[model samples]
Target chain A: SQTIHQWPATLVQPVGSPLSLECTVEGTSNPNLYWYRQAAGRGLQLLFYSVGIGQISSEVPQNLSASRPQDRQFILSSKKLLLSDSGFYLCAWSVRGPTEAFFGQGTRLTVV
Target chain B: GESVGLHLPTLSVQEGDNSIINCAYSNSASDYFIWYKQESGKGPQFIIDIRSNMDKRQGQRVTVLLNKTVKHLSLQIAATQPGDSAVYFCADSYSGSARQLTFGSGTQLTVLP
Candidate 1:
């Protein structure tokens, strides 16, 4: 009965503005967290993943960064947003081994 | 390098008919494969998964087939319904330590009512 909560469900940010997106998992501890972005027709791309607190791995180099502040809390942030940063951002959690990942509702970010 | 791809970009099927979605991968080390269904403006939902040890696995109304020799994967839905209409994506990953997944482009499945 684990659930992931992500907010805000939708966001609109001005170019060069700072951005922050939060995701937390309830009913699970020490779970593997991941950040993904889906662009138009580009498919889902893995941005970052964390194995534990204060440990983050970047899959692709970009303006966005991810942090695992707590065992269940993960945050994606950017100091300055770019027009290419606009996409549907998703947060997911999985067990230690290779297993199916559970995704949150996702945040639709639009940088204008 | 891990690369996953789909055979088609779109698929249209009649309601109550069977639907099949195909995917291909380049990494021979990939031992786990999964199929996901994504609605518009929503996260992808897990439909089914298959391990390399097994060639086939079945869920409620969904089935996943894995072919290691050809590095191909497929998802089959029985008696497709309007609710089954969505974008289907297949993902692959290694077994031991590498947990990161590589996802396919996805195939839009449109169910004609």
Candidate 2:
């Protein structure tokens, strides 16, 4: 069975501070990884997705960025955090083929 | 420009009654669709999925109906329970890119005893 792990289940960061959230998958290789930001009632917004290492496709322009350092390791980062950046960040992974993606526990970041 | 939208923002249902949540998509190329349920302060969980080729699919206590002609999708929960109370979202995808899904604004379902 495959499992996804996300760190810092909750974080409280100051405004303009740097942000880093990590997500990793086990029991699978070359999986498709995605980062999504979900706001109250706004739904899930796709921030970034990577089909392979060093290949990231940004869905929307924002203060956040994503990277795929290893086959199953994905990181979401920001040089500076904004008040609007605070939300539920989710990490998901799917097999290379047609399959539903599985999400992690998610990180609740609050920028004060 | 692909977009998915739900028909309602909130739905209140009585316990033991069936609940129906509806969604609509603007992308005609979308062939695959999925339904997810999310509780408060939690990530969305996969509930059920249906392909365009099929009109309906069933899970343990849930059913998903897809109407390609009208570009509408619906999730049906039978014998609704309090545990079933959550925000439900519908996602759509196409053939070439099956990994990424376009999600719709969720519908919050509240089960009342």
Candidate 3:
């Protein structure tokens, strides 16, 4: 069984402060990783995805960026946080092809 | 451009009754679809999925129906329970970019106990 771990489960950051959220997958190698954000009462918006180490694809242009430092470790970061950056950030993993994805618990980021 | 959308933003259903959530997509090239359930603060859980080749697929108590002609897909939950109260989102993907999913604006499903 594969599992994803994301932390901190909840975060409160001041405006303009730097931010970093980490996600890692276990029991699987070379899996596709993705970052998605969801506003309260809204659906998920794809932010970034990675196919392999050092390869990241941005779905939307915004204040966030993603980096795949390892085969199963992905990190979402921002040099400065904006009020609009506040949302529930989720990390997901999938196999190479079109298949069902698995998600982590998610990180609730609140930029005040 | 690819877009996935839901017919309704919210739905209320009685416990033990069947629940159906509908979704529509704009990309005719879409060959894969999926349904997800999300609790208040948790990540969306995979409920069911169907491919363009197959019109229907079933999971434990969930069913996903895909209609490529209409670019529509639906999720049916049997004997809905209180635990089923959550937001449901349908996603679409084409084979060219199956890893890249476009999600519909979720529908809030409230199960009345």
TM-score for all models, in order of appearance: 0.98, 0.98, 0.97
Candidate 1 DockQ vs. native: 0.77
What is candidate 3's TM-score for chain B alone? 0.96
Once fitted onto the true fold, the runs of candidate 2 whose alpha carbons sit more than 4 angstroms away are none
lDDT of 2 at A32: 92
Top DockQ hit: 3
Q: What's the DockQ of model 3? A: 0.80
Model 3 off-target regions past 4 Å?
A: none
Error of 3 at B36 (Å): 0.6
Candidate 3, residue A90: how far the Cα is off, in Å: 0.6
The DockQ of predicted model 2 stands at 0.75
lDDT per residue as tens, model 2, B1-113: 37799999999999999999999999998988999999988888999998889999999989999998999999999999999999999998887664588899899999999
Q: What TM-score quantifies how close candidate 3 is to the native fold?
A: 0.97
Q: B1-113 in candidate 1: lDDT tens per residue? A: 37799999999999999999999999999988899999998999999888899999999989888889999899999999999999999998896435888898999999999
Model 2, residue B102: C-alpha shift (Å): 0.5
